[model samples]
Target chain A: MLLAKIRGTLVSTQKVETLDGLTFFICEQLDIDGKPLGKYVVAADSVGAGVGEVVLYVTGSCGRYTDTTTNRPCDATIIAIVDMLDVDGKTVYNKTDDA
Target chain B: MLLAKIRGTLVSTQKVETLDGLTFFICEQLDIDGKPLGKYVVAADSVGAGVGEVVLYVTGSCGRYTDTTTNRPCDATIIAIVDMLDVDGKTVYNKTDDA
Candidate 1:
């Protein structure tokens, strides 16, 4: 899994049939320090995360493991909304601080 | 799936039991224009790609769908050796030419 920030929502009606009813979000990859990596991914939303929320996402076929994306061609899926991130015993990000 | 160049092989004696006997390779991501993208991945080799070969790799759970990686914890797998790459009606790379 990797960390990202939900940047915005994406709505596409002309997508593959299996992806219908799944919400997509534009996500910007985040480094461990909660800084943007300048890379982005369009991911299916499984956790109902809002824009500006840091999230944990899984890519590749593992993205299909979630109920909303099961057996779909979705390559990225938001699996969890991060509450806090700690690395090396130091707090790197906390949702409360941003909220 | 993505394009990558096989840079070298990897040998690990202390790895997860499921990953034992699997051959790993160091791969460098490649752009559509056949240029290096400055990113790298350690991938399990399923296609017996040699060093310096351009290969196609699959990440996530799909990496485990192959016979050699089935039910393994692998996140990346080299699935195919690329003979040529074409984009926008132009040949971007040809393995024979490189050879």
Candidate 2:
């Protein structure tokens, strides 16, 4: 799993049928400090995460473990909503701090 | 899918039963020109990719798309062995060139 922030949404009208009804979010990869790393991923929303929300995303086949992605072609999926992030015993991100 | 080079192998004696008989390989992420970027991933071998071979790996739910990874907890899986890599219509890596 990796830390990322929801950047935006992706509305694909012509994706494969297996991806129907799955919501997609644009997530920016974040470093341990919660800073953006300029890399972006389009992840299936399995946890109802909204834009600007910090999330923990799992990639590969783990993305398919959820009901929304089962047997789907998704390679990235947001698995958890992060309320706070602690790295090396330091609180790096707190969702309540968002403005 | 992303390009990567098999670096090493991982043997686990206590992994979940769903992962039994699955071979894991350490893969280094590769750039378009086939240079290692120093990031590593442990991928379940869906294909019989050998060490030092370049492969295309799929992450997240797509990793489970293969028969070997179906219903497994695998997140990254090697899908194909690369015979060559063409970047911008230029040949960057050729398996025949390996000496």
Candidate 3:
């Protein structure tokens, strides 16, 4: 899992039928300090995260292995909202720092 | 399968509960002349990508294995939609030049 920020949204008109109701968001990978890493992804939002929200996302197969993505064409799903992140015993995020 | 770009998008509403209408995007991670090597992701669109376009994603479990991401819970789902991408041999992208 990695820390990232919600940058924008992606809109697709003609796509797979199963994707019909599914929403897609534009994301950018972030560093430990919550800085833009400069990579992009379109993931299935399993958690209710909005723009500018610092989120925790899973990659590879874990991203799609959700009840909502079952048998759906999805990859890179937001698994949690990430209230706080501790790396090497350090508080990278506090959710109260006022971002 | 690396090379990526997209900017943001993440909207969660209480999450889980089978994730109502799965969709998330906010990616970063690009090189190969595309620039922006930041880290970020949240994907689930199978095609028809917008927001600066330039898409192509896949992760761990084949980005949810396709067929609409079998077994719910997705991973990383954009299986196709890259008009032209070639590494080593050159030509990173060629949807008709000019990005």
Best-matching candidate per TM-score = 3
Tell me how far candidate 3 lies from the true structure as C-alpha RMSD in angstroms.
Answer: 12.8
Residue B89 C-alpha lDDT in model 1: 41
lDDT of 1 by residue, B1-99 (tens): 566889988887988998888889999988656678899999998766789988766677766766678789888877667666543345667777889
The list of candidate 1 runs beyond 4 A from truth reads: A1-59, A62-99
- What would the per-residue lDDT of candidate 2 be over residues A11-93, giving only the tens digit for each residue? 33322445668876657789999778966556789998887888999876677788888877567789999998888999888
- Residue B13's C-alpha lDDT in candidate 1? 92
TM-score (chain A only) for the predictions, listed in order: 0.96, 0.94, 0.88
Put down candidate 3 lDDT per residue, B3-93, tens digits, no spaces: 3566766788997665466566676756545677767677765564655555667765665555555555656555544445443345556
lDDT per model vs. reference:
0.76, 0.76, 0.64
For candidate 2, the lDDT comes to 0.76
TM-score of 2: 0.54
Deviation of model 1 at A64, angstroms? 7.5
Error of 1 at B65 (Å): 0.6
| Superposed Cα deviation of residue B86, candidate 3 (Å) | 26
For model 2, residues B12-87, the per-residue Cα lDDT tens digits are 8997988999999999988656678888999998767789988767786676777778879887887666666543
Candidate 3 ranges with C-alpha deviation above 4 Å: B1-99
Evaluated at residue A18, the lDDT of candidate 1 is: 51
